[model samples]
Target: MIPFHFTGARVLRPGGLIETPVGITEGRIVDAPCGRAVDASGFLLLPGIVDPHGDGFERHLAPRRGAMLDMGDGLAMLAVELAANGITTAMLAQFWSWEGGMRGPDFARAMLEAHAAVAPLQAVDLRVQLRVESHLLDDFDAIAACVERFGVGYVVFNDHLPHRQLSEGRKPPRLTGQALKSGRSPEAHLALMQALHQRSAEVGPAVAALVARLPGVRFGSHDDDSAERRAFWRALGAGISEFPETLEAAQAAVAAGEPVIMGAPNVVRGASHAGKVSAQALIGQGLCAALASDYHYPAPRQGALKLAETMGLEAAWALVSDGPARVLGMTDRGRIEAGLRADLLLLDPETGRVGATVAGGRLAYLGPEMASRFFG
Candidate 1:
């Protein structure tokens, strides 16, 4: 690959924004000569986004109920979307749940296999994050084996069962639709949910044993609703809090030095659709560490720009890049520094649009307006 040098750009350096040339050589940013030069004047050059957790690709994998696309094709398309949005490192959050079909263990294993096969073909650094349902006690051993076989680096605990409804002996809302998607009868699904809810006591120990068996892997907790719940997850070695549902939970995570991740849509929308804690409030209070795209593919850049209205550019950008990289224990590609990976983005400062995106020293995406600058 030919070396590329970007000059006349307002680069986001460690100190602040500076007008200087950035060089890329052999996939790393370096203070070296270049084979080709691109004029990046009047553009804001920042680090490419490192999304720590996102399930936006779920739509691509299974666009409709019982209709699924090949995982490799889904992931390839996902890479383009990530590149277009200036994301270089992405953790695709795939669920291993008791929810029957796509969210079940079989689909999880299939996703891992497809990821292993297609990840090498994509420009973005695609990593797997296994989102395991806390109530899947029976699949703990198999899940652990899958993690080992796939070398999954991140694992997060999620409990989405409607405990209130289950304990009341009533079928959860939308039981028929969920059952159809899972290829199970509504009666069977209701029975399964009831069984899982009844075994909640044993599930905790089973989860603890599962975590104990998988030592040295990064773990996270989802939808923490209280300080006590956050503490419980912390004790289980889950140092990352994903989408803390309450201000207290977010505060607890922050106080304990855990990174709290909120959805980028919350920042862009100015409120959480779930009517939980506001992401902007969390950011303002220094409680939110990162803003992931969540279910939307284009929210990170737009959300950061929206947040820049209050927190300035560098601080807002950190929520999508540096903060997430730190949370994931990846110190390689989050910032624009010499010797780090050359994952960077050039944006229209005024429009807040991505003009070009370079991942691992390769120009993975280029917008039409900037076409002449590089191609001419």
Candidate 2:
């Protein structure tokens, strides 16, 4: 890789943005320039986005029903989108649920294998985060084995089953649509949900045991809706809270010293589409630790910039960068400092669009406007 000196841009640092020339060499930020100088006079150099959880790659993997032919190629295409969105390190959230199609255990395994094979060839650093259905007790052992086999470090527990509706012997909303996606008849899907709902008593212990088995992996709870729900997961050694649906859940997680991750869409939209707690509200109360892309790759950048309207760019950007890096236990990237991995984004100050992106000191994306600065 060729080294480059980025000059004249307002580089975002731990303190704030400053008119400091940045140097990158051998995939690390350096104090002295070692290669060609690039005049980034009109750009705002900031840390590349570090997205903790996003499943937008699912679209590329299976663009149509039963259309998942080549996962490697899909992942290759996903990398371009990640780079274009200025995401350096991203956790591709894949579901290991009872759902039989793209989100099933089989599809999750294939996605992990494909990512392992194709990530090395991409400029962005891609990792997998398995979103396991908490009530899938029958598959806990298999999930553990898959995690070990793929060297997956992050896992989040999810419970999407409509327990209330099932307990009341009522049909859940969208049952038919969900059943079709899972390749099951409506009757079979309802039966499965009822069966899983009946085993709710077993899920807590089973999930705790699974966490005990994977001592080295990071565990989190998703869509926590109450303080008790957050506490239950925290007691099971799951320290991270991903997208707490209520302010109570978020506050509980934060009070427990666990990092609370909210969806970037929630921040950008100023409210949750599901009518849950507002991410902006949580941010205002100092309950949120980081922001994840959720299902949109561009959201983190847009969310942070939107937040910069009030909190200042440095603190708001941290939610998408250093905060998430810390949540995932990654110490190498997410900051524009000497001796760190050179993961960076250059944005147009006037329009706030990403002009260029560099991941691990390699040029990942260069917009047409920024081409002359690098090549001329």
Candidate 3:
């Protein structure tokens, strides 16, 4: 690969934004141009986005029920999708839940194996984050074993059980469809749900044990709804609060020095689809630490530009780039700096569109108007 000397762009650096050109050599930023020169006039060059959590790849992996595509093929396309949106690093959130089919443990294991097979050839840094349903007490040992087998690093606890309705002996909506999806009868599903709910007292010990066994992986809790719940996860060393459902929960996480992650799609759409705490409102109040792509691949860039309404572009971009990198304990590639990885995004300032993306010093994605800059 030729060293890239990017000239005439406003670059984001540690000190702030500067109009000076920058150079990339051997996958790191350098002081002088060593090879080809690319005229990047009228562009904003920012750090490549680092998405800490996202389940958007689900569609690509399994476009429809029982109609799964080849993992390698799907992942290759996902790389392009992510690079087009300026994401350099991403955590593909896969679930291990009772929901079965795509979200079940068997599929989770297959996805992990597939990730290992396809990750080396992809442009983006794709990592797996196992989202384990908290009520899966029967799968604790299996989950721990898979964590070691697959070399997975990040895991988050999620509990989507309709505890309130279940406790009142009322069936949650979609129980019948959910059971069919899981290859179970509706009555069996209800029985399983009731049994799991009845064993609520044992959930804490099971979670603590599983978490203890995975010593090196980063742990988080999803959909935190209360300060007390935040405290419970904090006690278990789950330092990341993913999509806190309430302002109080977000405040509690922030107060305890935990990173609060929310969906970038929420910021772009101006409201939460689930009617939880608004991510835009959280960012405005300085409670949100980072933004994930969540269920939409294009959201981070759009969301950051929208967030620029309150905070400046530099700070807003940080929410999708540096902030997420910090949450994942990564210090190498979020920003464009000397001796750091050359992961960058070139954006057309007027339209707020990504013109090109460079991941690990390679030209990964290019817009129609950007060919001249590299080729001319």
Q: What C-alpha lDDT, on a 0 to 100 scale, does residue 96 get in candidate 1? A: 95
Clashing pairs in 2: none
Tens digits of lDDT, candidate 2, 1-43: 8888889899999999898889998899986766888888988
Q: What is candidate 3's CA lDDT for residue 87?
A: 94
- Name the top TM-score candidate: 2
1-376: candidate 3 lDDT, tens digit per residue? 6787888889988767898778988888886766877888899999999999999999889898657658777888899999999999999999999888789988898898889999988778899999999988999899999889988899999998899999998999999999998899999989988888898888888888888898989999999999999999888778899999999999999998899999999999999998998998899899998999999988999999998877888899999999999989898978788888888999998998889998888888999888876766
- Name the regions of candidate 1 deviating beyond 4 angstroms: 65-69
275-369 per-residue lDDT for model 1 (tens digits)? 99999999999999899989886899999999888778889999999999998888897899999999999999988889999898888889986
Task: State residue 246's C-alpha deviation in candidate 3, in Å.
Answer: 0.7
**Candidate 3 Cα RMSD after full superposition onto the native fold (Å):** 1.3
**What C-alpha lDDT does candidate 1 achieve relative to the native structure?**
0.90
Please, what is the whole-model Cα lDDT of each candidate in the order they appear? Answer: 0.90, 0.92, 0.90
TM-score of each: 0.97, 0.98, 0.97
